[model samples]
Target: MNRDLREFRRLERLCLEQAALSTMDLARTGLLKVADDCRAAAEAIEARSPPRGAFAGAVQALKRAPLAWRVGARS
Candidate 1:
């Protein structure tokens, strides 16, 4: 999922770059629209997804827990 997000971002950049280089108004407008759509999609996905470090945060929280709070703690 992270990889896919990065790919969407990369595609947005590529579209913007190509738009900058385009000589025709229509082509540039189309490319810019495509880039905007990619950016919007990426933002939407990112907003709905957990942060990349969410798993690490969970692990860190577990580390802070008392030994007895961990799994398989003895009675």
Candidate 2:
């Protein structure tokens, strides 16, 4: 992975970790938003780069994942 992509992925991971530890719903939501932004940056970088191996397929699957899960939708 390139420097920018790697950094974005790292930030995403950190944000997710923080969200997991968050006690307040609002804080967790904000952290998740940051994580999503980092993921978007990584995706943009990937979109511009040529597809590689299994990683490329994983990225495609993530894109197809349900929006409800990402947004934590509740009934």
Candidate 3:
């Protein structure tokens, strides 16, 4: 799960660098928050869908966050 999260985060960063994703997009599409939401998301995602497990977990949790980290990110 941790490895999956790391890869997810890497891809998220990649998107940010490319300016293709906003903070909301990161929280939604990448399904992640590196600093605070990581652990809870990992566990919840694993519990709900063990088949995709880590990947799905990350995406699920990412969908739930407020995305307060980047205000006006799309602008």
- TM-score for each of the candidates: 0.65, 0.67, 0.30
lDDT of 2: 0.86
C-alpha lDDT values of all predictions: 0.78, 0.86, 0.52
Where does model 3 exceed 4 Å of error? 20-75
Q: What's the lDDT for residue 25 in model 3?
A: 59
Off by over 4 Å in 2: 52-75
Scanning candidate 2 in windows of ten residues, the lowest lDDT window is 66-75
lDDT string for model 2 (1-75, tens) is: 699999999999999999999999999999999999999889778767766779887876676476437557744
* Candidate 3, pairs of clashing residues: 45-57
Residue-by-residue lDDT tens digits, candidate 1, 1-75: 678789889999999999999999999999999998887678656656654597865754564465336434755
Query: How many clashing pairs in candidate 2?
Result: 0
Q: Quick one: ranking by lDDT, best first?
A: 2, 1, 3
For model 2, what is the error of residue 24's alpha carbon versus the real structure, in angstroms, after optimal superposition?
1.1
Clashes of 3: 1
**Which runs of model 1 end up more than 4 angstroms from their true locations?**
51-75
- By TM-score, the better pick of 2 and 3 is 2
Task: Please state every model's RMSD to the true fold in angstroms.
Answer: 15.4, 4.8, 11.6
**50, model 3: CA deviation in Å?**
14
